[model samples]
Target chain A: MQMTKIKHHLTDALLMGYAAGTLPEAFNLVVATHISMCDTCRAALAEFEAVGGEVMLDAEPVDMAEDALADAMARIMNAPQTSLPKAKPAGGVFPAPLRDYVNGDLDRVKWRKIGGGVSQMVLKTEGGASVRLLRIPAGTAVPDHGHRGTELTLVLQGAFVDETDRFGAGDIEVANEDLNHTPVAEQGADCICLAATDAPLRFNALLPRIAQRFIGI
Target chain B: MLNEMHTLAKADAVTVMPVYKRTGNAGIRATGANRVMAEATTKRMAWVTQVAAVRDAKDKAAFAELFAYFAPRVKSFLMKSGASPDLAEECAQEVMVTLWNKAHLFDPAKASVSTWIFTIARNRRIDLLRKQKRPEPEDLPWGPEAEPEQADAMGLQQETEQLGQALAALPAEQRKLIERAYFGELSHSEIAAETGLPLGTIKSRIRLALERLRHTMK
Candidate 1:
């Protein structure tokens, strides 16, 4: 089997938060997507989950409302269909997990050009974080930028190399305020990524900065 | 092989939950309590087997047993994590419903029944909190997909027992941080700010504690 090289795995803090269900949806998506591809992180997550269960078992009990079980039964009887949503095929580029969000294949994504041969389509989700799919034509470079909050980018197709490392399909890059980089997609194919950011990016140049405001990035 | 057997034998000597069980029937706390406690322990340990029954056979009896045991525990958990009593009750109810709806997705290798139910409770509570402000997303995965391989029963049993031992051996300070992160539902920064510790210290303490846990349990 040819293993996908994923050099930049998520930090322990993020994974713990994800396991405990404390992270926002965007962060959870990144964590879940990365976990689908990385066995190492999946194991770490299992440990954290084990810890979560132990704490729960050890917690002092509080009396529940008398009708809680009956209420639960009522809800279950009327629960929204329990069947797993059938994720429309997204071919090979987008995994089933990501396809569920976009709701269709690559052709169905609603991309808007954000200038500089790059386009983005924001996926609406609950919570404050911003999540979007980005498309960069071959050899195109995003603005050199820092972060105001955590940003996680997972490469879906093609490849992008930044100041820190090169990421191909299935690899993830986690960036925060301490880091700054210009991510340029390698030539030969267009780079597509699912990027989730809790806050706006910090761009160095004036043109991109103005575009960022308009693009709602 | 002999060494592993020896470790397993030594592990069987420990009964870890005596320190943690909530007080029941204060008048009978001294007498007959041990029997009640033993029965409870047996019931708790067998929860995983019951969960598997729910998964494989759609056993209503098994699910009822789970609901009776876990519903109050989940409510207590949510309340301790700063939710109101009523909100906790509602979240717990929702969590149980999800359990019934999604029982087929539960895998013993991925987590113990307690762990699986705990994650569901935690997520359901968070979803309730978020639903107040915005609509919930329809696309989130069922959860982190652990490997598909069915784990060895003896190995999994030993891991759970050793996990309790590892948790018991942890220093109180490190244990508190872990409890706050997992059960108290506080993020690292929130825990740090609430505890007046530096963010880095909070992160490192949790990291160190998890490292010790993994080392010891393994």
Candidate 2:
């Protein structure tokens, strides 16, 4: 069926973390990007947000800084006209939130070849975790590896089949140390993914491991 | 007149019970129910109408209404999630300012005002939290369970209400984990540490709680 349905949607607890403001920025980006594309996750996030609202309403009301309203109004009046940063003009197939990070349309991403027919563009973000976009050629496979830490891979386009399952556009595969599989792109198209990892991967092959030291993959 | 008063008193009594059970405070729940219902309906409309006034017309009155509604609530939320009062208030102001500027991005088809505001407020809070310490890498909190697939769009409102009801019905232990994460702003590892439970237990308990919520809402 060529990846007709998403088999792996984000869980409620993760959505709760995203809604409640606990997830790290990298995870938050993954969740936000997924929510933009997945209707089910979007609806789920809204419910969590509604619950967040209810909880806020139920909290012990703190008396404001006496001039809070006045100051806020003053700031709003003098506020520099800031719009949400425009989505990248090269935002092809990229959702708005992800595009905010990608910063330009598809052509703008300066991909550097890492090795083995796979290239990557590491996104600069403020955190200990790392986020990057990977471009794997058609019919190629990511070096099979386990994670030293959690890894979240969200498909931006095309599809990849691994030992676990197939992930198409908008689907994310959450992998930790216990899971290891090579994600092989289907024959027809290249697979592009936004992947975030907090630690170096445990690559199975000797060559990728040596290259990892230099290439920082 | 006597009969009418009696009927209102009865109506108030009937309305209070479910909410009182949910909130554990009857006096507030009874009062809150009417106000919340009224606001919820207004917010649904505001996503379509009132928000546009702030965006297109620069309508101060419309902006004032949203500010009055969301600002303090956002502050309270940050406070509950571990921000100091001053920080929470400052972040709240930032959230409001961002709201003023980003009003153009408000898409009613995508999300309602509170949900969008919730995203902004929490983003500010999370950014503040991250500045304090980076989290250790860890697994996600369990997984997505099999379900009735996506709830139809028409069912979203009902699903949210049902979700609330289901949350209220959860066993205290499970609900406490949710509260710790949501209100306490603890990550899975931090939550595991604070509660002295194994990380796996925390994830599984939460996963079970969510599965129950999903099934109940479905």
* Highest DockQ against the true fold, candidate: 1
Structural similarity to truth (TM-score) of each candidate: 0.74, 0.67
Weakest lDDT window of 10 consecutive positions for candidate 2 chain B:
B12-21
Q: lDDT tens digits, residues A1-217, model 1?
A: 1237667776777767776777777777767767666655666666677667777877777776655655666676666774866554433556556666776658879999999989999987777787899999999999899999888998878999999889998788888889999999999899999899988999999998998889988
Interface RMS for model 1: 9.6
Q: Report the error of model 1 at residue B81, Å.
A: 3.0
Residue B51 C-alpha lDDT in model 1:
62
The sequence of per-residue lDDT tens digits that candidate 1 reaches over residues B73-138 is: 888888877788989888888887778777766655345677778878877766676552222222
lDDT of 2 by residue, A1-217 (tens): 0222566787666677766767667777777777656645655555567666545654556666756666766787776664554232332577666666776556778899999889999877666677889998989998889998878899878899999888988788988779988999988889999898878899999998999998775
What number of clashing residue pairs does each candidate have, in the order they appear?
Answer: 0, 2
Q: Which pairs, if any, clash in model 2?
A: A90-A105, A91-A105
Give candidate 2 misplaced runs (Cα > 4 Å): A1-5, A80-91, B1-70, B97-116, B127-162, B165-171, B188-218
